[model samples]
Target: MKRLIFFLVLLPSLIFSQTNFEKGEKLFRDGKYEQAQPILENYLKENPSNLKAIEYLGDIAGHDKSWDKAIGYYRKLKQMKPSEANYYYKYGGSLGMKAKEVNKFRALGMIGEVKESFEKAITLNPKHIEAHWALVMLYLQIPSIIGGSESKALKHSNELYKLSPVDGYLSKGQIEEYFKRYSSAEVQYKKAIAAGSTKKGSQMLTNLYINKMNQPEKAAKIKI
Candidate 1:
């Protein structure tokens, strides 16, 4: 009789907590972060160890560009679930964005941690496409003196190509475009369009023809 009374007393609170989480998660999935944030925060207070709530809160913070808050949440998640690849990826991404806003020297000091986090995510999940893309961009953007290398970028791009040919072509095109190799970029973009027939690929190729190559006629001829 005592145990039954205890269970009855706990059931209502548990149901209420679950209901709040469901409602918040629904809003989150619908991209209504503003509406979801407070509810999720409240739910998290009731269930501090709830991974989904923590992740949602972290994602909301990231969307708001509150990098420090996002980093704190993701760091806690990493501590809670060390083997989870996505937590490491999110942590690295938030850290990288924060690094960009700081002084160059401070940012430089953070580069290794950002690199290692993404690399760890990749190591944990080889088929993780986003991690590969992140590494490609990281290697491309940093100076050569600080471990940046076109060859390293291309290596990740090549890896992307193995996993996703369209992305591979697009990333390679982006690298060429970054280096002002308009013709090479054009070739890669064309390949991307052929591989995926995606609007993004079409737009990139059209933009290249118009902006870089100064060929408005070719840009106009591009078929979506």
Candidate 2:
């Protein structure tokens, strides 16, 4: 009688209840992260290695700005779905964010991994805009001795242009600004404005006038 009673009490905890899992998922989709986290966490305790649960928990960690924890979850997702572009991109982005917050040695250590993850993401999906853009930033920001190259940045800019016309001009504008070619950057930003991305185009052009061109009056008068 004692053994039977124990089995009955333990059955609920042992079962992989779909109802509980789906309820948690609904809460997640509804953007109720606080409510969904514990529910999803409890479900995973009973059903460890649950991929869907792992993915949401990763997102929750990102929302919480717990970059390392988010990276851990994303790493698990990447292991489970090696060919998934989104996982690699998210993992790479989280690494970059964490690198920014850490010491120089640790940030340097992560640079290669961050590049590799973004590379994998773009390889899996050529149209992965963020991955490509992130790579462009990496190439632009790091020193040429390590990996940075304007030529490489330009190549990605061209690729981005092919993928997104608006972002293409904006990216080209940024590259010109990096080289201190203010007039060239202005041309690209103008092209972007003419192409209908007025808001970003206007902001970049305004900054250029005020910061690069030293024309604060012109910047203040400018309108999209």
Candidate 3:
């Protein structure tokens, strides 16, 4: 009888330890991050080779903005599965967020890390629009002195344009307007409008011509 009781007690613990992933997943889905973390962490401690567990823990840490923990989890996952593009990209994003909390020099390193991750993502899956756009935005935000390249930014922008012409045209127009290329901006904006942009397109066109191009009279003549 004592043996039976001992077996019963140990069975639950054994099951819990082995199938902790299901429990952790349920907790995460229910938004119980605090409860989920420990269970996931304990499971990962023993099964350091479990990519799925590592990925989930990284996701949880990221959602909570626990940058250090998230980076640690993602790095482990990346090391385990070096060929997985998404893993590296996710690690890069975590690093980028953590960088924002640090000095500029450190933040610059984070940006470089982000570029490498996104580049690898693109290499692994050229059709990844999110990674492509992220690279474009990152390059644009960096200053020339800090290794920013306008040409690289434009290249991504053009690729994005080819992938989604309407969105690409509008975004390119916005970039042109930023650089004071009013004529080019106007043409692209108009193209977006004709290509079935939302009402926001009309507003953008009106503002660009009136504010940037200094032609309110012409902007007023444009019909929505």
Highest lDDT model number? 1
| Candidate 2 residue lDDT tens string, 1-224 | 99999999988766646677898899999999999999998888878789899889989988988998899999989998899999999999989889989998888889999999999999999999988888888888877877999998888888999999888898899999999999999999999898888899999999999889999997887685
Candidate 3: stretches off by over 4 Å: 1-15, 165-224
Q: Which stretches of candidate 1 lie over 4 Å from their true place?
A: none
Task: Indicate the worst ten consecutive residues by lDDT in candidate 3.
Answer: 132-141
Please give the TM-score that candidate 3 achieves against the real structure: 0.69
Arrange candidates by TM-score, highest first: which order?
1, 2, 3
lDDT of 2 at 20: 79
**Which predicted model would earn the best TM-score?**
1
Model 3: how far residue 130 lies from native, Å: 2.1
Every candidate's CA RMSD: 1.4, 4.4, 5.6
Question: Candidates' lDDT values, in order?
Answer: 0.95, 0.90, 0.82
Write down the RMSD of candidate 2 (Cα, Å): 4.4
Could you give candidate 1's per-residue lDDT for residues 138-194 as a string of tens digits?
999998999999999999999999999999999999899989999999999999988
Q: Give per-residue CA lDDT, model 3, range 115-150, as digits (tens).
A: 888888788877677777777767777778766776
Error of 3 at 152 (Å): 1.6
lDDT of 2 at 224: 58
TM-score for all predictions?
A: 0.95, 0.81, 0.69
